[model samples]
Target chain A: GAGVSQSPRYKVAKRGQDVALRCDPISGHVSLFWYQQALGQGPEFLTYFQNEAQLDKSGLPSDRFFAERPEGSVSTLKIQRTQQEDSAVYLCASSPRTRTDTQYFGPGTRLTVL
Target chain B: QQQVKQSPQSLIVQKGGISIINCAYENTAFDYFPWYQQFPGKGPALLIAIRPDVSEKKEGRFTISFNKSAKQFSLHIMDSQPGDSATYFCAASENIRGYGQNFVFGPGTRLSVLP
Candidate 1:
């Protein structure tokens, strides 16, 4: 079976530019999550979606970060007006059931803001 | 505020030795404790997990020791091998009756096992 996958493995953007990262969750997975991982640090949660409805987004750093799962299988994390501080790896994970289940993580998209 | 705290930002152990990484969490409501392993560019993989109901859980060479009262947990790798070298992260989450969960992760410990 295929695991969660992310696209544009590496992305470089200029400051103030906009970028959208994509995540394809496992087939039939019900829970999707986005996390940001800084260099030498643990991953921090950004948002979560169960099916097509977003359940929690309190972890989003600011208003610039937006995420959506329109069809409930693919998700996109969009960052508006990228800043130097946004240079980090954005990871996506999915679970078969609820968030309590084991989560399969995507390779992640490394974004570098210059 | 760091909800979860881990010690020894990095660790190095020789083959056949034991590697131990410790973690402490502040929230008592956290019922789930899980450990994840990550390589250079890959995403984190679930290594093992334990619940507050159990004090210890062991699988193969990995063991998780949980101290409920102390709010601490540790991962012990017996006979550590070079292939086991990776960054280990400890996370805690409460089982809220909802669609989402808030997982608080530790700073992570980079483990390097020497051959």
Candidate 2:
């Protein structure tokens, strides 16, 4: 009955620093997704994973953003050389299949790069 | 060219009044539309969803009206209450891979219901 959860609810990093955000999907869920939400804006897709394989990562802003889901359970979104523009809430969601099915979202990790 | 455009940015309604939020999408391949509700410091929660097959779907006091020809959709909340005050987002989903989906979200509309 537990929903998706994210860690380090808040993170403040200096420019050029590296940060890794973690996401734990719901039990038995087969689909995982990452999104970035800016202030006063809706969330934009960052990457998606089906089981341990990443199906789409075209939404990733740049090469600095890397995500991996090993063992088909937990996922980590890593941002290398953080920039001021990277400041936003990173959201993770899990679903049984796709967005057609209801996806449960995590509280999100707010990252601020100064 | 995949974009879900939401309008009115914000809305304020009195108790018992109706609240309506509209969204238009450019992609016709989108087959699933869902509305998400979010409160401060919380993740978005699914409010209602509609498939292209149906013109309209109503759940409790929330209703989703879909216009397939117009490529638009709207959310109507009846007897809006203060508890219903939150940000609403309209999203379009299209399945790309075997089980992968692409979600295009609107800018979002902040709704404030006065007591």
Candidate 3:
């Protein structure tokens, strides 16, 4: 409510297992984004949605990485067939407008692939 | 390819000193630049931002300097405090003739402020 929120702050999955992370954006936000951050590195863009429309997904590492904002208020990022390299912090951010604006980020989900 | 480049992988500064972090980008189309600050186990927060139209912008103790010709920008924290110790990232984005814009972030700079 106050800001962006993410569920399952931490996740541990075995190789080949599938996992889904959820994000709840600020109320009435029009833009949502997902990013992956590896150890000691900055966040890399994964996908972006504008009011339930998947405008861009070119940054997703692989086809296994899929994201959806069906209702536009909430979003989910599902990773299928996880690999060791998939272990990283997944971040969700929301902006008030569809155009460039200040984004509020959630705590992020730390996915550890064993 | 890395669209954004940052210098000084890590920095240590004393309290009350000026802390500076630099970043460069190759894409001239990037018109918006923002700097984010992050703490351990937390998400990044928007510290300050600047547009290409202005050469510099200041808010409180933070300042963003932009060099349009060189496609470079930097963040300056005045009177650094120990509480300011964190990782800083510089990001750039262009208006993609679409509904939303994508961001390109640079390798972060870890700053430690000594009290």
Residue range A89-113, candidate 1, lDDT tens digits:
9999999887565888999999999
Cα lDDT of model 2 by residue, A11-113, tens digit: 9999999999999999988899999999999999999998999988999999999999988999999999999999999999999865446889999999999
lDDT by residue (tens digit), candidate 3, B1-115: 4389998899999999999999999888787899999999899999999989999999999999999998889999999999999999999988778665678899899999999
TM-score of 3: 0.97
Model 2 residue runs over 4 Å out of place are A98-100
Alpha-carbon lDDT, every model: 0.93, 0.93, 0.93
**Error at B20, model 2, angstroms:** 0.2
Worst 10 residues of 3 chain B by lDDT: B93-102
Report the number of clashing residue pairs per model.
0, 0, 0
Clashing pairs in 1: none
Model 3 scores what on Cα lDDT? 0.93
- Global local distance difference test of model 2: 0.93
lDDT of candidate 2 at residue A102, scale 0 to 100:
83
DockQ winner: 3
Q: Is candidate 1 or 3 superior in DockQ?
A: 3
